[model samples]
Target chain A: MDSELPPLLVLGPPAVFNIFKSQYPHKYRFLNAFSSDLPLLQFLQTQNTHPSSVRAIFCNQRQLVTADIIRSLPSLGIIATSTVGYDHIDTTECRRRGIQIATLGSQFAADVADMAVALLIDVIFKISAGDRFVKKLVPFKPWSFPSDSKLGGKRIGIIGLGRIGAEVAKRLEAFDCIIMYHSRNKNPSVSYTFYSNVLDLASDSDVLVLCCPLTEQTKYIVNKEVMLALGKDGIIVNIGRGALVDENELVQCLMKGEIRGAGLDVFENEPYVPKELFSLDNVVLSPHAAALTLDCFMDSCRHVAKSLDAFFSS
Target chain B: MDSELPPLLVLGPPAVFNIFKSQYPHKYRFLNAFSSDLPLLQFLQTQNTHPSSVRAIFCNQRQLVTADIIRSLPSLGIIATSTVGYDHIDTTECRRRGIQIATLGSQFAADVADMAVALLIDVIFKISAGDRFVKKLVPFKPWSFPSDSKLGGKRIGIIGLGRIGAEVAKRLEAFDCIIMYHSRNKNPSVSYTFYSNVLDLASDSDVLVLCCPLTEQTKYIVNKEVMLALGKDGIIVNIGRGALVDENELVQCLMKGEIRGAGLDVFENEPYVPKELFSLDNVVLSPHAAALTLDCFMDSCRHVAKSLDAFFSS
Candidate 1:
């Protein structure tokens, strides 16, 4: 390690640490926590330098920067997370301590929007279901299977018309989808119809794409009533947080065909998705990987490095 | 049946016959072949009316209109098919006999284009594969799976820049993909780059989308050499006829990792896909349902009925 290099504590999924270390050459001396078998507190205590030397902590959603973790890092000036969502970090504590926060921000918008559209298209066209049917060697009769819905001219309701939602709208527009949205306030920049309430948006739309962050007011935003309003022909695509939808209601609706289908990238319980969803052909499930594309991940890695460099220099 | 009503022969999948009969009402007297237990010729002979009275045939890809079938209907004037591809009919024989042929034409282009983009996104983002992995209840880890490729900034070469190809290019452009083409002639209407030779196009593209019609000159157009040119990271999306690609070569290339993946909606033989494709996560297979969306199917049915009505009126 270069003596002149600034030291930063790196805590996240081992994969992120490895990628940053390998792909991003050393601008900072990364004190990788995974390199120590000891617990995080003990690892920090055992470091040759004082805890105050580490001015910034590089992390992601995999590791939470709880109040305890923040307290232990005596001189931590900023919590730089390589994810758009910072719900995992102790922002309240950071606010009290006057420690700033830096996030990947809109850097992940395009890749996540691509995933939202991809999932929506997959559901409407029955691509995943058709793939299973073909691979299972089911006897194919001409026009035997129920016909799929076309993407063109369908009204798509975007729950959050933020960066990702705007990108989703832009892509789906080429498919001729009617774009509608529900957000905190009416956006003056775009011409898409805005509904203040999500229920009204669901009733008038064919598909609902969740792209909002998980906040107190937005948690369980898509409940049973909202789903019913979307009707039996509706589809739900969640590229946002898992808790944005009530997973139980979603599973029940999918099971009973209350809603036509769903393409879920995030689940309430995460890796512990309802086993009932396993057999449903109308539903397409993905692990939480909306922003995991190589391009997005590398971009985020670069953003994190830049944020750290700026914070330490200031 | 009304004596003034024009008698017409309907031979195709039973679904088409049922839908047309139920939806089309009393426009004409349908001499449905499936209604009789006897062979088609015998069924016509057993009918009290003369075979020459049935002057038009309404069929689809499910039924072949061969020279023998045409010979039996001495007064046959037109063969109207409810599909974009007219290769199923004996066009050469129709030309010799001075009989007219009508197809759905560009009506199915939008639906087919939608499927092409859906398949492309599904393959590139690993949507189907991710769905399978999540459904299979595999242990999920952050950044565990290989990072997926992004759609933006990718060079996509369209094999046939006709109506369907043009529609596909329009949709993909919204995702920020660079569009190139290989067609019979340079299409001057659009500004997309055109390549007269497909090999050069393959070399320049990261993805190849097949949208051309299948004919003697175009059969086996994407062979081993083209696949090799596409390289290991390249993907092939076939929404056109299956015979356009050498299935054996494609299967081998996919198996050897010579090419990244494939999204096939058509095959050399109908309903008989290669068994090797069953276990591959890199491939998404649809049972020839590209133009089978409910909206598209109903539209084509209406078009077929109009074609038949026009022929009978003349």
Candidate 2:
């Protein structure tokens, strides 16, 4: 801990903290909350040795930076997160306080988009299901084999036309899919047809991809009516937060074949995926790791470092 | 069985035969060889009731149309296959006999390319592996979770830059991959870097995708040397024919950790995947059904009918 260096509070686990230290050494003297025995608020109070010295906080997905934490750190002027979504942070309060917030925007977009497409194709084509079928050496009969739908010309409804949603749209265009979208506001640059609400989008779409952020308005956005409107042959892909779709409704839809399938990378309560999904061949589950690829993580670290450097230089 | 329709010889199992018949009823009276207990040659003889009446042969992947079959069908003027690859058909013999061949050309390209990208991302990101890991409730720890490479910024070497290969390149380009290719002859239309030989391409690429046709020149093209050149962290995706890669050498390389992983839609033998691959988490296998999506199949049937209609009208 060098007193001459700027104090930066880190509120993540060891893996990311260690990477940050190794990649950007001596730039900031990091006080890791995970390594500290005291509560995060008390830890912040201890770091306030020199008044207004601790001007930066670094966090990842594992920690929440609430209004209380913000009030406790009076010197904190900037919060840089290494994750794409900033729902874990109190963005409204931060905005009111004039505290600058930096996120790994568009860095995880490509990888997350890739995962979304991967899961969609996997579900529609039964790629993972087919792999399991073959690996189990179930009798090899072509006629008896499960059939899968083609991706071309399918109606794809994207929930958000932001960076990740746009990337997904671009990739699916090569497959000749008909792209439609629903967003907070219509993007003028894209030619994709926009729907004002999720219900109409689901009614017209064969597949609904959720790439929007999770907020109070967005939580449980894909309710029973939306799923029912999507129809029996429809599919859903969520690379965004799990809470965007009602988990219980989604489970019922899958079980009753109300929807054809789902490709999920996020869950309502992560690391504790519903056991029901395990037996369903139509659903593909990932452990909330859509953006955990090596390149994305490394790029995120670089982005965090650059944001910190820019903030201090300013 | 209608004598008024043009006689067409059908050779394959029932699955594709049923689809073709349902899609194009009364276009051509199909002579079902599989329905008959007699040999395929004998079946062809039975169909040759009127000389030059049986002008076309329709076949799928399950059976072969050898030079002998071409000689046996003296009145055969064309062969329209419901598959993308013509390796099962004696193309040279047909060419020498002045018999025109119509294939499901570029019809399956998009679907196959979709499968190729699906498998590549699956291998690179360990999507299937991660699903299995979570499904099995393997103890949850961030560090213990499998780490996967990213698709963006990877050097992707394509074996053939034809219809399917070019489609693959186009899709991978969206991921920010640097595309290089090896083909029988360089395609001047595209600007992707071309290598005269695969060895050089393998050395420079982090991933090698095979989309070339299978021929004597291409059989076992990916041998031990090529795998070694690709190094231990390399990935190979084959949406082409199985014999394009030396299966034995590939299994050894994977077992010994000479290469990173593989995404195989085809195998050296149909419906008989390498048993060793069953235990490996690094490889993703399909039952030679990359282009067998329902849309591709329906489109292929239409193509075959169109070709037959044109041939008769001419």
Candidate 3:
């Protein structure tokens, strides 16, 4: 409502955009794209009398900041996403334009890592399965449920020992899990064993957890060979992107019993999970909502606000 | 099968009894109650030609070691249970008869703690709820799923600072949760803040986890007043006995939204969860299988065997 406040463009829905506006109520004047019936670019141009005044773009995971959108914002100095992953943004265009980008970064790392560990334990111990069994009132028999694998002393192979992976390792350490990891390069500070390749990691691990960023080089990283290497008793947990794993291969592996089980938070096509996964008892499926907690959302809002303030001040 | 070996009575089903027998076949001569067509008491008397030779009883959670059963085994020097909880055995009678009792004490602590943490995270983060949402193809609308509470920085009150509770506290510490606890006595060794009463503990905690042994004093420990003190946003995780919390009161609390949610591994009546819980989204039900992992089972077997050897040799 204050004209003197720098104009900030918001490309997300009102629910998320409102949080940003409320977080920095007087710091910046928010121009919400979803508020108007006009096209995003047209809305952006008309909402702010001086288009060049709109210096920062606040976006969410659902909205993509394409090259066209980025080109339209002539004076856009920085893009701050309320998500850990920045793949939704056109980084190439931003690089060419010399625009800065800031992500939620480690703000979501703890929450996502919590989810990764939750899924891993759920799958391994059949927590959800047992819940269903009890709730459904399945007949009680000797060993009615399948025997679950223990979390302690299991060889856990973490893919990408970034902030989230490191947090997962830290939490699982109390369980006495033997931790090893596969990252781009070895993290000398961490004592966990490192494997140069995913295949070797899978071969040695009882559980393979995907925590790396999704990129061109890392797409479909957990392929058929990796799953096979993980062996019949092995399990996979992906709190990262669905594309990081070959979804079809994963499905096939689960169906044919090539691998033991999987705990998936993200699917190849989100909100469009394979119908086949619905009936399987071995897999635990979560909506792509590892970082959807109220705390994480609030933290992300604060991170975005801080980034905006820092960028403007700089 | 060796007649010269000390006789050990097994009161579980053939499936579970077989695991114990095979674990240490040469160590003791097993007299399996399920193997015979007669009743357990008749099998105990008839199967063992010399009833006085039965010096130990190997039992699982499903079977109760009643006062009569203990009295029937005239020479029963010890009862070795393959479970952490020994409530199934009449401790009064055991004490009266001067019979030693050995339980799988700390062997299953890590596994049970793992389950407690798993259930807590699952309930707090709505892991299973999100899984159901994705699996059921609930239309993806913005904020369709309820926002979840984060694990980090929450006040967690653990009931009982025993081995399992200690392990739980240790694991949760990595998540940055503020751990406080209530035990029969203040645990001087533990740095966690101890509340002298359950109500006080419930009032201060966002999550109240039951890890205490069920006893006359502890039965229905979490009553209406305690649940009320926990308030509308609090969650309860029970990896302890079913009767520790008043199940009727719990169902009412959940129904009336007195508490946010519950993650229950045990019930007032297990294998027969309250039918009402089946429809509720707030609760996660597990069929008393928290310590039912194959690793725990194997470890329990080993513990029982060691106890037998120790008791006999002493």
lDDT of 3 at A177: 93
Per-residue lDDT, model 1, residue A33, is 83
TM-score of 3: 0.89
Q: Rate the local accuracy (lDDT) of all candidates.
A: 0.85, 0.84, 0.83
Model 1, B110-229: lDDT tens per residue?
889999998998888888878878887334543345454788899999999989999999999999999999999998899999999999999999999999998888999999999999
DockQ of every candidate structure: 0.63, 0.48, 0.60
Q: Residue-wise lDDT of candidate 3 within A4-105, one digit each (tens)?
A: 888888876523565666667888877877568888767766765466677888887677899988887789989988778877799999999999988878
Q: Give the local distance difference test score of model 3.
A: 0.83
Residue A267 lDDT in candidate 3: 79
Candidate 2 — which residues are off by over 4 angstroms? A1-15, A21-58, A67-79, A92-100, A137-148, A306-314, B1-10, B22-57, B68-79, B95-100, B137-148, B306-314
**Per-model TM against the reference:** 0.92, 0.86, 0.89
Q: What clash pairs does model 2 have?
A: none
lDDT of candidate 2 over B37-144, digit per residue (tens): 887666657776553567888887768888887887788988888888889889889889898888888867878898899999888877777777677734444433
lDDT of 1 at A218: 94
Stretches > 4 Å off in candidate 1: A1-7, A24-39, A46-53, A137-148, B2-7, B25-40, B46-51, B137-148
Off by over 4 Å in 3: A1-9, A12-15, A21-55, A137-148, A309-314, B1-9, B12-15, B21-55, B137-148, B309-314
Candidate 2 docking quality: incorrect, acceptable, medium or high: acceptable
TM-score of 2: 0.86
